[model samples]
Target chain A: MNWALTLWRLASFAVAAGLIALWQLIANLKLVSPVFLPGPDRAWAALMRGFSNGTLLDKTIGTLEHMFYGWLVASVVGIALGAMIGSSRAMRSYVAPSLEFLRPLPVSAIIPVAIALFGLTQGMALFVIAFGAIWPMLLATVHGFGAVEPRLYEVARSLHMSRLAVIFKIALPSASPDIISGMRLSLTVSLILAVVCEILAGLDGLGHWVLLSARAFRSADLFAGVILLGVIGYVTALAMSMIEQRLLRWRTSGH
Target chain B: MTSIALRKDIPSAELEKSQIAFSHVTLDLGGKTIIENVSLDVKPGEFLCIIGASGCGKTTALRLAAGLYQPTSGHVSFDGEPMRAPRRDVAIVFQDYGKALLPWRTAAGNVALALETIGMPKAQRPARIDELLKKVGLPNHAAKYPAEMSGGMQQRLQIARCLAQEPKALLMDEPFGALDAMTRQGLQDEVLSLLDASKATVIFVTHDLEEAIYLGDRVVGLLPHPGRIGIDLPINLPRPRDQLTTRENPEFLRLRRELFDFIKASEA
Candidate 1:
């Protein structure tokens, strides 16, 4: 690897270290009770302990399963809806009001309704998160697809390209960047929704773990869970965006 | 597939009868008329270039000829039959250097996409693709994607792809407009050579008046804003045009000046 890139990575680590040091110094100086404000070391130790027994791994996998499923379902449905909205003026005009109304309401805001319907189950959390995450994807898809060159569409028609060929080869790749961007933004929202549902409903996921630890004065475990969730969210976003970049190689077709 | 052994000697009269005709065509875009009562007649193998300013409806008229768009008034017909949609026998080369090309496909594969679109036999496509690539002077670039190639290379590939369809008539929308001077000169020669070799009638649209004069048997100029035929001039320039000789010729200068005067008047 180039030294510049290596240095950038090191710098990022250094920033994280500085933040941890500051937090630890503040807690130690009695800025907050040790019972409530755990040092980074204590959180790290709790993280290692949780991983050593696979309890953290199990809960992480559980949360991840819900997240991926919700993401997949929402992405598929959202893309379809968005394409339709983009292509047809009538659908866009008709569907605009309802989608606008539904999108602004927080995923957590729908938790009571989800619990009432699915009784605090994984389905309930997944539904809330997926529904929440879908708007960004739909909006992005509509905009991205709408923005594809009209000349390109006419070319497709003149070439007698089949509907499937046009969608897969033309529409999807063209719209992918915006779609992935929306999805990247959605992943964070999904995590927030998942955590909110887990904590408020006392469901068996990361947020539930954080709540349990914090309630029992296990501040280290609570911080550890929070940090793990952050890492998961960040890593997933990075990977998806990388895929977006690769597929959009054509967009950079210039010297 | 070339079956040289079994080819019968078809008469020129019979071939000339199968011509492309645009009959008093007027095109409308969003309630704004572009082509106003424009008529064109092309004999088989004729290279006709439509020259005009930007937004002069050169492209609109070409689209009508290609049957991509229907005339809001009058009609574009092929051998007396009104064009319903894109004809199976015609191919178009867009100016955006095949930005319309499916990105997933290789240069050969982009050509092959038309084959696939028409549901041609899978076995015949590769050989045809190779022949076309060779014809377009891009045999080695066949495996490359449009994104990988230079603008000129991409245009060559697109032309090669159009050739693979074995079109009876070619409609090109200023295919070299995006290229630099040297590359544009090279591709123009390639296009001329291809036209010389094939019997395909061509209706090329270009904003470049010199280009219109250089390649066309007849150059039709359209004026912008309710685009109508401003001038239609026939060129008697000899085949295998010598770049230096043709550009320096007094006759060529006279034709260009006349075209410029017409265009200037149109702009005014």
Candidate 2:
């Protein structure tokens, strides 16, 4: 079984390598203009040069910092609001309609309004990123806390637990699986929105680097920036899953 | 048997000394009556079993005694005082041990949840948690989560958690009904031993007539469709009941047969 799993993993890598090789062939045959689609070799060289000169490293850090801060802010606000709304029947009834209306409003659509408010600043990017990212976490928390096993509440009641005690000791832990899943989704949203905001606001991040390279007709540089963004997404997702595995160890390790 | 007459025959003086009392308690949910005009009194440290068909409101009756639900009419009380809300002195053990336990927490952590709710000092919790786990025969499995434990082990953990509350009464809703025969018998004896030490009043609800007779000092049967007491029979079996011997005793068998007949007739 272990060997079969290893073979399957190797097959996946082979597929990815095949796709890249196909792209290299297309570029070599000049099916796409060199200005639009650079060969993989040129992209690789650009990536190395950018890193050696430290420009790529600075931009990567900037993007990561922006994404992390927005995600953190969204997490705190989402959990607090979700607990308040989820625990109280009256609160849920009152707030649910408004949330339904606001949740689906696209964050990119509000970018113009945000730019008007914060004007090409990091604050604008943060606002846009947070607004886009908070929904998944908030909804997940509401779902988690709301779906807590009714028996656990009965247990809490029989123990004469205070309202606060129920929330902390029972509700929070009970809702954690949902909350963690929501955070993972929110982190992904934060990254996407962070890039969008940086590009639109002309902030100094990978998104801005890509946008500048495109405008300057530096196709290899643009491809390099896009590749780095993929790396960032991969690394962050890997890190988040590790954290999830640790936090929810009980679920995976037990029945 | 005239159950209502049996209730009436109980002296008012004895009623005052009752640990838990349901006086003409009628509960209605969603405009439908669940249990109507049910009256029963549990003596201090007595193990009372309530048995009935499905949807007969035995669990609902247990909930009223636990103060998780209030009766639509009449009163339910603990120690002569109206049970307005759940009190720290009463703990409940639910039948679905899988749902009853916090899956995220280990056995020790689940026990600690009860202690934490009662506001035990942080510095003193570990010792008490250890004692409670040991009491439930889960001393070595403290670090295991509920999912890691067998059904019997999970039920024992639930019992351990409830014991941590130091409750004077335990309201159980078919707590051992889901376990296999062997595990159920083991837990039945384990609970009896635990009660021997704590002397807590117990209101155990189940549909199993033999189980009722084996574990209860008195077994009360409920008639379905707006449940009401159908029979209230006292078990004269000896204490520290041996699973094989007590079950074999003629008196135990007679009481079990009587309860069985009551349930069958009520269902019909």
Candidate 3:
């Protein structure tokens, strides 16, 4: 099984590598302007230069900090509100329509309002990121809590569980899988919003760095910055998956 | 009388206590009647099974006994006190064991939930949990999650969790309905022996007439469309009943035939 999985992974990676190789070949053959698309070597050189100067790392760290703070706040508030709303039909009915209206508005559209309110500060970026991240987490948590088996509640009642105990011990754990999946989505959204906010607000982040490179006609540097963002996104998703696996070890493949 | 005396390990003073009773109980749900003017008396150490068709509301009656539901207008009491809510002294085993046991908890953890409810100290729970698991024939499955176990194993684990309560009354709602025939019979005997040893009052609800006769001290059949009692038959088969002998006994056969006819008529 391990061998088969390894072979499958290798095959999947080969396809991705083939795409990258084709992009590099196209750049080298000058099918696209070097200003529009640099070769892999030029991109690699640009990445190495940024690493040597330490500017890239600083911008990456700044962007990550904004994303993380916003994501954290969103997660805490989303779970609390979701649990409250999910556990009671009246609360859901009262709040659900407004939430639905606000949810469909894209995160980028909120940037102008945030900037008008908070200016080009970190606070503006944070607000945009948080506003974007909250929806998926909140929706997922609501769904998870709602889908809990009725029989489990009956069991909790039969055990004479206090309402608090029932919520904390039974409801929360049962809803965790959906909550984690939501968090994964929100985390990715938070990253996207952080970059967008940084670019729009002119904050010193990876997004700003990419904008600076593009203005100076440094296509290779711009590509390097985009690659770095991709790497960060991939790593964050991977970390979330590992945490989910560790926490939900009891969940079988059959489930 | 002889079997009752033999099963009574308690002091004579506590032997004949009335554990649970339902008096003129009428249950209405969503403005529609589910149970109407039904009465029952569950004596100490008795195994009473309620059997009926799909709409009979036998499970509703069991829920009332477990204090999960309240009668529209009547008394459902435990030890002479009106049952307002579920108490630690009464434990319920739901038919959907898959939903009843926490998927995240191991078998031992599920059993420990009862001990935790009783506020048993952490230090003493392991020994008690081991004993309960052993009683349910799940000594090797303490660390297994409910999803990892077979249907029969999960049901056994559910019973173990109930036993952890040291309950005076056990309410089961078609607990073995999902299992195969052999597994159902095996669990039926296991439950009998455990109840015999603990002397807990049991109210088992099932639609299977043979199961009603095999495990119950008295089998009560409920009629549908308001869910009232249609027949109450005392099962006089001897104690320590075997799958072969007791099922073949004339009394068991008579009750089975009577219940079969009653259920067929009710269904029609």
Off by over 4 Å in 3: A1-4, B1-6, B10-17, B257-268
Candidate 2: chain B TM-score equals 0.93
Candidate ranking (lDDT, best to worst): 2, 3, 1
TM-score of 3: 0.93
Q: Where in model 2 is the C-alpha error above 4 Å?
A: B1-16
Return the top candidate by DockQ: 2
Assess the local accuracy of residue B59 in candidate 1 as a C-alpha lDDT between 0 and 100.
Answer: 83
lDDT of 2 by residue, A101-197 (tens): 9999988788999999999998988888888889998998899988999988888878778899889988998899999899999999999988898
Instruction: Point out the higher-scoring one by DockQ: 1 or 2.
Output: 2
Tens-digit lDDT string for candidate 1 (A1-255): 699999999999999989989998987797999989888878999999999999998888877877788888888899999988887789989999998898888766788888899997888877887898898899999998888767667667777787778776677777887888898888877787778878877777888898899889999999999999999898888898788778776666545
DockQ of 1: 0.31
Instruction: Say which docking band candidate 2 falls in.
Output: medium
lDDT for each residue of candidate 2 in B1-268, tens digit (9 for 90 to 100): 0111111223457545999999999999999999999999998878899999999999999989989889999999999899999888988898999999989899989998888878899999999988988988999999998889999999999999989889889989999889999989888888888887787889999988888998888999999999999899888787668888888999987887787788788889
Ten-residue stretch with the least lDDT total in model 3 chain B? B1-10
TM-score of each model, paired residue for residue: 0.88, 0.93, 0.93
Please give, for residues B179-238, the per-residue lDDT of candidate 3 as tens digits: 999999888888887888898988999988899898888999999999999999988888
- Please provide, for model 1 over B1-268, each residue's C-alpha lDDT reduced to its tens digit, 9 standing for 90 to 100: 1111212134678555647887788888888998899877887777899998788998888888888888988877886788888876788899986566766567888888778877889998899888888988888987776888888888888887777677888999989998899998778777887766676889999888888887887898898899998888988775557667777778789999999999888888
